[model samples]
Target: MSTENGTIGSQGEVNGDVMLTHFRKKDDDDANGEVETEETQVYIENYKDKLLIYGINDSPPIHVTIICALQQGLLSLSGQLIVSLLVAEAVCASKNDAFKARLLSSTLFMSGITTFCMNIFGIRLPLFQGAASEYVIPLLLMADTDQTFCTSEPSKEGGQSPVPATTTMSPNFTNSSLGNYTNNDEITMDRIIYNVQMIQGSLVLAGFVHALLGFTGLIGVMLRFVGPLTIVPTLTLIFIFIVGPVIKFVEVNWGIAFSTIAVAVILFLYLAKYNMPVPVWTPSLGFRIIRYPLHQVFAILISIVLNWLLCGVLTYAGLLTDDKKNIGYNARTDARIQIVRDNPWLTFPYPGQFGPFGFSGAAFISCMIATLISVLDSIGDYYACARVCRVPAPPKHAVNRGIMIEGLCSMLSGAVGCGHATSTYGGNIGAIGVTKVASRHVFIATGVIYILFGIFGKFSALFISIPYPVLGGAIVVMFGIFFGVVISNLEVTNMSSPRNIAIFGLSIFIGLAVPTWAKKHKSPVQTGHAMFDKIMSMLVGNPNLVGTIIACFLDNTVPGTAEERGIAAWQVSEEDERADVDRTEFNEGYEVYDPLIPRSIMYSKLMKYIPFLPYKRGNVEKELGNVKTS
Candidate 1:
């Protein structure tokens, strides 16, 4: 092993099974060339002062594992449900309670499947995968521009369209004759189904492209040009552009919405350090009190539950309005109660469950753009997760495998008609930092729990029945966190430089301006070809896409050194030829990310030649020698 002092063992002495531990004497050597070994405690210098309850590779007791898993599962589930609800609203499915419930169930199921696969075979990090808000931006844009769904103008005050009355007609009607149409509900259902099918097809195509990028090692090449400057504006605009949707939900009942936001803000910020004493039982210690950060760990969930109860009580007391046309009517707890009764007890989402898939060039482009952003965000998430887990940064091969798996999961999501892609949950990573539990076993168990909950249709129905105001409150806090996190990327760049400031300012300004102008002036891009015009208009109108393209163009072309542009720190070397001692020492933390397979097969000669494998041919020989010697 090697440390700051020096290497402590010969090459043959390195043992793969040995846990990483190092010690140093407090006092220096005396004048006689002998060490002055003072009486001192031998502490693990790698994690010294961190006091982590569980490390990346450590497996806790079964009970502890289940409890931690539940916490993570709930946090991820909340985010996924919110994204599903937003997609439902965008696609004009808000009035169809059964369809909304099905959408929620599908999203949850896919998230569980993806999260499960990610932990075992993907990056092997303690990160949760869920429905991403990034894709929602494009979905919203697509819905707004669709001729079938844009027959009526949305309300100018709240940006919400009136919810159509429920109908009894089946959504799977195949009659294409206009004479078969009985009411507007039939047309609305057909449009929603068609749009969902289009999304599924585009997601499948986009996912294939995404997987190719990873499997071919193109993602690493693309990262060479990406820096904080490009990421900051792209991600910032993602959250900022979603304000219209959040406002639509929040305006349902400002009183409840603001209350929810206030509770979340207070719990997450003010009461974060405060701990609650909880009783615990163990085989050795019968009963014990443990200090848990309950508020910090469950800030979002608690706020939703508290406000939901409040809305329920107010509804029972006849305080909330029941009038369909009145404001704040959606805040009532019974607003979507019918969904709970309509949903089945169990739902197993399968491919082509919705209908025959449909393809669209415009939708494909939008999904591809969103997929690129998801890739960039996930790369950053990997580094952040590694730092929080106190492990070495993930190697390039591990990252490629992670991206490949993510793309496959998105394909699965599309097949099931979830209308969104899956990405790493940043909130769960933040929970790891607060709870100090980064065990992969815990996350794996959490994935199983997610699968169980996803199959229980009633559970998903209950979350879908959450009041719009409460959801709005949660969205405000959730997206607010998302915006702040991405904006913090600015810390890595030379913010003091006028060049950077000018680039950021111009990109954001044009990003917002172009989209607003396009929205006001329909058919702004008047190319002779209708399809080409629509695609070009969609690309230019999206704030995130515009800002990303502008920022990337400026950052790459502008004259600046790598260090000044933060590229030096942002980019990790593809290969590091460290000395044998240093390589063994670093592997202690990195081995946690290795694939769940026999080392004999993983480091075999044939496997070493594969670009996506974690080990190289040269390292295989050295690793085999160490194994044989040990």
Candidate 2:
């Protein structure tokens, strides 16, 4: 044991492994220098082992930044497009090619705006914000409850509704035909518009509550009970529940889908280590050969491009038939080619662009629940991003600020009628790990690229034209990675403990089983009030939210040590554990997340009162002393 000032640090053996314990001297005169045993466990992983080519603060050359930005932009665009397409199908707007194209553009626009604002004023991490897949669950539930939309679902028997046959196949398809909406088309458009409005209003309300949670520091208090067991089941169930839809998409063209999957797997796994030489010209060095991890960095983008090209070739060669009734007709690249010509050359997404906002009690409740889940996911992503970037976990204030920014951004997404909330893209975080470039500049540049593409309507429409099977294949790999990342949370937990195993297994199994049951037996939650019935049904039907609730309840109530529950590592309090950590190291980590303001202003005493600012010299000293005496 060693004592410095009033702080005490000691090491002891527990189950043959060393455990660190901290204590502080008591101020009471009941005994002679009696000390209180706080027993605050510290689990500091060696983040320095994983070095980066361009760190969080480093700014690469302009050319290099643009190249990296483009790669990240493509990944972000693909993710946003997938979620938008899913939302379109859920709201029965898949047949409205024009509206679907606009929705995709709106999603991209909001993602870009949020990504830019976040890196500049929020977490200051290299996290790319995009449409969250978790919101799809609630939308699916809403669609099921809607009588008009769910009355005769053709997509259920077949796959997603293909582009209308009336849409011209010409490269310059006129907008005159697009504007000729029949009575039936008008009704469908009204329903789609109404559904999007409901989503918008609900997201706006949820974002306000979400922002309040962060601003008031309530999220920090809630974090006390969140652990790996709670997080693992909650996040893993998200991908697990979406398997049916992914399968439906892949079934559109099994051959094309599997080929896309094979290409992704080969590039991401088998050829990850192979480096390709690129010739570059610079004023300092006229020409030079730079070995780049091309396969690793551009794996997903390359796979999509290659498969898309193959699909086009097959379509042109008459191998892929264009019959509307054909099984694999939607696999052809030209299936939705009219979308590109129908969309304007330039466009802007503004609030209430999709008619006035509307609210539904059931939708609001479901969105609120999804907002909470998104918060938890973002917190976990922050930690993972930090670890991957070779930095200490973010401090409390930085995390609170991040959540607040996400809430505000979600509101923007809703206002713009994106029909989905924005959240940190886990795939991009993994990309950071692979590419060894976590520069905020790269992310900011990527955000600019997103904004640019979003403004150019034709570009967004071009991407929206990707074949369903190709996207399905990519979604499979993406969601699979997501599931794997969620499960990786178990690394810090004592998995051997039956207590932990039982909690996770029961939570996931019941979570999945109950949702399946609810789907089969519709109207399982028929309360006296119609609104209440809708709310209950939607809540009960969401596998992620259900699993999260179960995991949190069991994890908190069940008796288990901190180590077994994984809370020891998950709940790292910067304020409470400051005495045990090196002062310089702690400050350095905090600085990484500090705002772009001058240090003097950011660390000012006034900033201490703000819940989201990193004020280093405020009540920290007093809190530490109080903690010692208490």
- Write one digit per residue (lDDT tens) for candidate 1, span 1-630: 655534354323422222232334433456654664433222112221233557778787787788778767755655776688878876677666566677888888888898899999999998889998888877777666655553332233434333222231224322231122323444355556666776788999898887887787777677778777887777667657667767877999999999998997887678665666667664743666655555665567688889999999999999999997887888999987777787778878888776667676777988998898898778777866775666666677788889999998998898888998999887677667655678898888887877877799777667667888888887677656655555665766788998899888988888889988988867878879877776777777778788888988999999888877777755645354122324322323557667877776775667655545665445666777886998
Off by over 4 Å in 1: 1-53, 60-68, 71-82, 85-94, 146-192, 249-275, 290-295, 324-327, 387-392, 433-436, 574-588, 605-609, 616-630
Write model 2 residue lDDT over 1-630, tens digit each, in one string: 444545544333221111123345545544765655444534222222224557788777787789888767765665787689888877777767677777888888888999998899998989899998888778878778655553332232324242232341122322332343323444444445556766788889888888888888777777788878987887778667667767776898999999988997887678665656656664744666655555655666688789999999999999998897876888899887877888889878888666556676667877888898898889878877776676666777888889999999898888888888899987787767656678899999988888977899888778777888888887777656655656777878899999999999999998998888888866878768866777678888888888889999999999999888887776656474343545333322545787777655654678767877766654655665665798
* Winner by lDDT: 2
Q: Estimate each model's TM-score.
A: 0.78, 0.80
Which lDDT value does model 1 have at 384? 63
After superposition, which runs of candidate 2 have C-alpha atoms over 4 Å from their true positions? 1-51, 89-92, 146-188, 575-588, 618-630
